[model samples]
Target: MDRKDISEKYKWDLSFLYKDNQQWERDFERVKSLTNQIKQYKNKLGNDSETLLEVLNLQFTILRNIGNLYCFAKMKKDEDNNNSMYQGLTDRAEMLMTEVDMALSFIVPEILNISKDTMEDYLNLDQFSIYRHYLEQVMKKKPHILSASEESLLARTGEIANGPQNIYTMLNNADIKFPKVIDEEGNEVEITHGRFIPLMESKDRRVRKDTFKGLYDVYSQFKHTIASTLSTEVKKNVFYSRARKYNSSLEAALFQNDIPVKVYENLIETISSNLDPMHKYVSLRKEILGYEELHMYDLYTPIVEGIDLKIDYEEAKDTVVEALKPLGEDYINVVKKAFDSRWIDVYENKGKRSGAYSWGTYDSPPYILLNYHKTLDNMFTIAHEMGHSMHSYLSNKNQPYIYSGYSIFVAEVASTVNETLLTDYLLKNTDDIQIKKYILNHYLEQFRATVYRQTMFAEFEKIIHEKVEQGEPLTADNLSNIYKDLNIKYYGKDIFIDEEISVEWARIPHFYYNFYVYQYATGFSAAIALSQGIINGDKESRDAYIEFLSSGSSDYPINVLKKAGVDMTKKTPIEECVRLFNNSVDEMKNMMLTK
Candidate 1:
């Protein structure tokens, strides 16, 4: 209603976790003292069973405490970047990380000192039953566990190994600036990363062209440095994988959650086999937009004419809850609590972080940060993040400390399931042909971006990391050309492939994450199958899904997903998602003809 409310209202309340700075300071000191106490267990862990359990439990308690404190401070700083108190708290947390690292450095080696037979014998002793979960995890890494001195040395290298990514973040987030574009109205518009989206979505083709060139022009200037940083990141993955005795970087990365290599390969092969449907969807876009030739920038503009659903914050929340009813009373109730209990930040405030993320600690409620405009995209984001929060809540309620962190493989399933349910609900609820077409087109676009586009990224990531692992140099031109080739495979035959899109890889932050984007494709596939079952009103299906969410990391990620009735080991779920994409493309084309 008012400017202050519009800007400030976008943030969520964090006061429930810590009332004020004085209390937060007290918690910080408490954690620091605990860190000191933890060192008492360094050389003393192997003395007896009771001593080891007490030490491990104390460390877990301290960690969860630090997690809550750090997350709260970081969330506050992200909400309003200019807040000095929040800034100080974030800085202090980073410092405490080193202290925490030093305190726990001896535990892994000490655990490794216990013989396999002795560990099994100790687990059978009733007095140490509480630490069974902790022992199980440490023992799995026994082959890869290094000596205490080697482990400390590797940990110390974190400052140097992490330097390149820190530079990339600084350049992208703090230092880089984009040139302004001259609008058709003859006014100059300065381009920011946030403004780049609205500019590319401009109805005027010239404005879109200018915005694309203007943003990349700045990126081109720093291309070499960015390329080097990316190269180092890939090499770092290889180094760790080899040191840990994994077969490849992909194997080592997936090993973090104990996921099988089959899941990753199945995603790549299945999605690669289904690229035609996405190409067909792009062809439909070109026809509906009536573009004589559609360029990369034309992809974001709406294809359906005279259709507007400018949903504000409150409207978005209600619609999200209503659309998710198929998930049952308990699911809907938690969503309602998110609204009533201030679990979300609904609008953007000055100096806040860009984009959106779902964050929470084991000790506190899940919270979300969003810079909402009145777009349909924002509504989908609410559903997306609530999916994560509700998943965390269920997992924390059901699992132990060692099993609380769920894998990204299953994390995507929960979020995408929410999106698909909302899409199906909206299409069935609306009779307006234009709105229906708009929503359907939106769904098709997601399938393209998440499934097809991300698979291309996954392939590119694999190729580059392999090149680095094989001792190939990764120059700017070499990286660009490989990226350009992948674009050709996905969209070259359907849409015009601009040379500029090749550099698009350098700008993506996910590239730094090392074999991470493939899950977006697999997650969507699993969600498609899971949501269909829930929407069909099967009580067993609904119960199975809730159970999957509650299972967390107690079992293998693939096993957890299979219990929910979606198997990533096979290719059927991905094929079903591709079929869904193809069906939507047909619907869009048919609607265009009728119009």
Candidate 2:
């Protein structure tokens, strides 16, 4: 469906951000003026607590306005990437953001120069109470904080450093094209990135195989270019890691959120030891589908038949509301506000960005974008994105602007918890054998994709970064070999590890995101624990989860999650998730046997 044909109520009301572009432009100019004003406070942070507070307030005000301006422009661009006007707006907004970062670059180093006793004295003042945690976080980075000039130089190079990711986004989203493939109906359809997954879900093995080959054929063609882009991104991570005096890129990435390196290592270690369940899942898929040899192309195809649930957008909203009622009345009311306040841009259109996300700034309502199709998967996606939106809403309402945005570490926890609740709700409420089997299958698949698959990705990321850190070359052949080997180990000997799956690394945009994909796996595990707590525990459990949502970046992400009852520092969550996966698989086996 085209965006224009979609009803107005389905579209997000961006006017809540600004009445018009003219208003946005006015804020744009105001931000530019404020950026210039920020220069006056340079090197004066230690003058007094009052001076520090004043500068901080000005910085916050400028950033708050900039957030609204950038959110509006980028969201406009995402609505239709083909729109050149919004494209330009997004570019300008990015540049302005860079300028602001450069302007405020000295804040950290200058603040760090203050003696710890002096910093504590400032924190004791009533005026600085709210920013106490913010300042403390800054202090934690004191060792990595460079000189003022060096910091400013690093900040100024931000745009240049983002060149690799920008190029990859254009290539993946805009430039590459897949060959036409014959569908199950014997009709030739041009393949696209957005259509690739749905094609993989086709029951017709021919369609799935054809789409897999067709999609990878395009990626393989651009192997050299993509490899170069990926290599540059890795080197960029290395550059920043060394520049900031971090032990490694992993350290640098995790340190920003104050997560212990062991957390990352523990996730990998626990998942590695628990690969038996994943292999069992692969065997189950092979047996149920009656595949002589299960291939990578066959992984996403549904194992059960007679359970093709198609849910429209309206039904998805209602189902999500029903599913999330365990979160409490206030939580449900916030979700209702999201539904009624036009906080979501639903449906896909020509040039609309693919995938789904929840985004917004402190000054505006949290917004979500989805290319929602009428399927059970799309319904779960609605619940997932709404989880993020509600987290943002609660955090923004309760915390200061600086603390409003949560870390990516805790970000996925909220979304995945919602998904877990939805799955549990569906399983408990449905009496039909087919529907129960389908929901159980979906749960298993979630573990496979989110936990097993992402853990494999995380391992691949670690291998490549370690190689780069050791001064090993990252050519196409080398990267593919590493990925292929990992794929073999994770999927086990029961499945055919297709050669095309090696080039799969070339297409994943997350590799460009330094040390980011690991969070999905960890977050899924954390969500499993949190969801269990909410379902099986008392009102205190539910209240703690809500408090975690509203806490935002006020505390370390690990601490926030601990308060919510998940101790990510240990391997317990990963073990629990694997246990859940095993139980679901066993249930599926029993259901299949009875049938």
Candidate 3:
């Protein structure tokens, strides 16, 4: 399992980024020199359009180089964590980046200080077109930008602001431990967050119930303490929002990407109005398991068991290519290039990174690092990451360096679209009823977890933050009650909402993320709608989707999605997604009943 033992093709060829370490060293030195030189423009940003444009150009160059250096060194370290050389390089790169950040701290604040008419005049310049959006974003934050002393004071309070999340992390990861439970084999297994979900999927009902109760029972014991942590977290958000002059914590959180509060409202309102499908899915789970009443713990177990498909790397590649044919030949050929060329590090090796991500510089190939094992989930991971890499590849090909990176708001859309297409292709191609049934169930789970579940989390966050904004206290009992009510509303009457489930919010780390869970639902909803149009072979829709992928941050994230076939500002995408979920439930119900 050592990295040295892996075949050359199975590993990433980082030479695409740099021919050798010497090239990387040369670039590192170049960045250092540029960092030292960039300070010359620190006070001259408001001098004129020419100087401002020049400074912007130089700034991006330094950033691009630093990005390459950090990405390369970190990826090398990821390939083998025990490699000391790359570790040193990564440290050095990180330090240099810090220095560069310090050196360039004046860029944005000074840009904001410029008069709006002057900034507009600069944006109208021919050479400033590429940096137009970048400058506009700076101007957009002008109202929120504070005085230097005030900003410094707020910056100093960052650690205090982050205390809640840090405390929650230590508690969840290190402090609290779940009691030992009897696993499926009658062996005593200590329950932990890492093993909770897989244990809940155990075929033995006793194991599922024990793990579920065991995990939540520990959370229940810490309910009051965690409620305080979450309350303080909410208070911290409210403080920052009020300090920054935003109307609410939710608005402040969404404002970074220029997302309006209406988008958040649309997500909650649309999904709430369309909960019948989610309820039906839950009801069908009770019927499928033949249970008098399905407990919350029973949800993770496979509805159609005995259909574990073992796919190899080769088969997964072929299947991914076939599934993605709807996107166009160009996209397919690039994925093929990723496979044939060394654009992917495809397997697990000793000390390699655990999960998969697509990373590269603007100049480097859109490289993927995957710890791929040949399970169905792993196959889907390939398609999912391929979606991200392709998005990067297309954007890097199409846009300038300044505008080449897209927002997190639309990032999940590409990956999930790939997943949706793959699921559709598999269902259509497979005649085996068992495999068909499994895929259908998998589709239903995707909607349940990504769309419905995340929307519920988003709604909870909104409610808690709203209460804090309105000066209401968040007691342990009230928090638990709010969570339990939402659980009942989301899962419906067929499943029992256990008392222990009320404390579930005590353990969720996302609650401290300040309104971050809603993007998952919105992005998933948009992907389903876009993927459905592409699957129907609508040429205009397919091309627009491709164009959306190629568009990085050239426009606002919402406008970027709007340019694509789906509009997140309206309720259409979420409704379209729920419709698909309903049809899939019907198909899956018929399949499960017939067999």
Q: Which candidate is the best by TM-score?
A: 2
1 versus 2: better TM-score goes to: 2
Q: Mark the 10 consecutive residues where model 2 has the least summed lDDT.
A: 190-199
lDDT of 1: 0.81
lDDT of 3 by residue, 1-595 (tens): 6788889988889998888899999999999999889888877888988888788888999999999999999899878766789868977887787677667767777888888898888788888888877877888888887764566466557646767976775566546768999887789877754456667767789999988888888888888999999999999999999999998999999999998899999998988999999999999999999999899999887888787566889899999999999999999999999999989998876556556788898989899988776566678889989999999999999999988998878988999999999998999998888888888887788899899999999999999999988989999999999999999999999999989889989877878888888988999988988887899999999999999999999999999988786778888888888898999899888888874
* Each model's backbone clash number: 4, 0, 0
Residue range with the least summed lDDT across 10 consecutive positions in model 1? 1-10
Tell me the TM-score of each prediction against the true structure: 0.93, 0.98, 0.85
lDDT of each: 0.81, 0.90, 0.86
Please write out the lDDT profile of model 1 over residues 293-335, one tens digit for every residue. 8788778777878876689888889999999998889889888
Taking the tens digit of each residue's C-alpha lDDT, what string does model 2 give over 349-460?
7777778899999988899998887877889999999999999999999998999999999889999999999998898897898888888888888999999999999999
Which of 1 and 2 is the better model by lDDT?
A: 2
- What are the RMSD figures for all models against the true structure? 2.5, 1.4, 4.1
lDDT at residue 449 of model 1 (Cα atoms): 84
Q: Of the candidates numbered 1 and 3, which has the greater TM-score value? A: 1
